[model samples]
Target: MKDTFSSAAAARQAAQSEMQKVDRGAATLSQALGLGRPHLMPQAAVTVEGFKPEIDSEDWLVKSVEHTLGDGGFTTHIELERQGDGNARDQEDVEDLVNDPKK
Candidate 1:
């Protein structure tokens, strides 16, 4: 026996496949930028359930949206600026501190 499905279902499946392909391309681009993997990117964070960042200004949200949709998906910052302020904790540093016997 043969199975049959509606054209709409086929179209939906095709669209989903195309979207996955695009997401793969985006992930590849993201990794090439020294941004680690796509899952580590800002957009991935935004996808997490219960993840909501409360920026004080609409300007910040607009800037964020722009970055997510724009090439590189991030603002062009120099090495120094990208490192951020000295007072901010680095994830690696925190992990090292937690695991170190000396700490």
Candidate 2:
């Protein structure tokens, strides 16, 4: 019937429009994440070390944290350093530096 044919055509058009919207959104997201262009060199494997945290050990102290964003995606690297000898003054200084409210 002509009604049935028109209904099928309308459904196809709606599906196509939805697909176009999805494609545009994907393209925008890829560009925003810096993946629109090809990378000159393939991304290297991410290496992580010293992630274990011990409640009683000094290994819980965070030495530094680094973040890298590229075509591959975002990667976070955290380095844990052992606490120095139980010196109260040094520990206080380190705590102050690490827990700076302004930072």
Candidate 3:
């Protein structure tokens, strides 16, 4: 994601802060629980109680939110993503899955 800032200094700060990411796409817990009312939107801060020590985290920030109203059901779908530490974290995730037997 990219944003426009008034000065170059502000842009640099933003870049430094968002350097690390956590991917939650394959994780079931991050899935949205049917939203009630149109309350949240993109860029909103929502707390997530994570599972792992350093992998699962509560530092979740809302990327996008969809609020819908229609006949019977919304009759549509949604899209969401969580960022992980680029490539290394992804490899770790795969290894965890393969080595884990309780899953």
Candidate 4:
């Protein structure tokens, strides 16, 4: 009975140690990724045009950038612009500018 209890205690200790290591690794990764810790992560703080749909799209873009850049190397900035109506050429010009890689 004594041996059994000691063995169980040792196993528990080992498990706890491993868990601590995993937690540390997670924290390191989170820091490297430019993300705040779980409870205090930084938010984008942007004004979305279409709240529901736009938020989803923004989330997707962020995730994609995260995947592509590994961690803390990516950021997204959203700007709201108001262009007057009856401006087809202006709209097309803006669209082309957005599509172009070097604008």
Judged by TM-score, which candidate is best?
3
Tens-place lDDT digits, model 1, residues 1-103? 0223255445434444444443333221111223323333232221212223422111110111212325655442211001112223344543443344243
Report every candidate's CA lDDT: 0.29, 0.35, 0.45, 0.31
Error of 3 at 89 (Å): 14
Candidate order by lDDT, decreasing, is 3, 2, 4, 1
The C-alpha stretches of model 2 lying farther than 4 A from their native spots are: 1-59, 84-103
What is candidate 2's lDDT per residue for 13-51, written digit by digit as tens? Answer: 444444434332221101122333222222221222343
| Clash pairs (backbone) in predicted model 4 | none
TM-scores for every candidate against the unseen true structure? 0.23, 0.26, 0.38, 0.23
Among all windows of ten consecutive residues in candidate 1, which has the lowest summed lDDT?
57-66
For candidate 4, lDDT tens digit of each residue in 52-102? 563333321111112223355444322222211223235444444334424
Task: Name every residue pair that clashes in candidate 1.
Answer: none
Prediction 3 global C-alpha lDDT: 0.45
Q: Count the backbone clashes (under 3 Å) in each candidate.
A: 0, 0, 3, 0
lDDT of 1 at 52: 32
Error of 4 at 95 (Å): 59
**TM-score attained by model 3:** 0.38
> Candidates 2 and 4: which is better by TM-score?
2
**lDDT score of model 4?**
0.31
Q: Give the least accurate 10-residue stretch of model 4, judged by summed lDDT.
A: 59-68
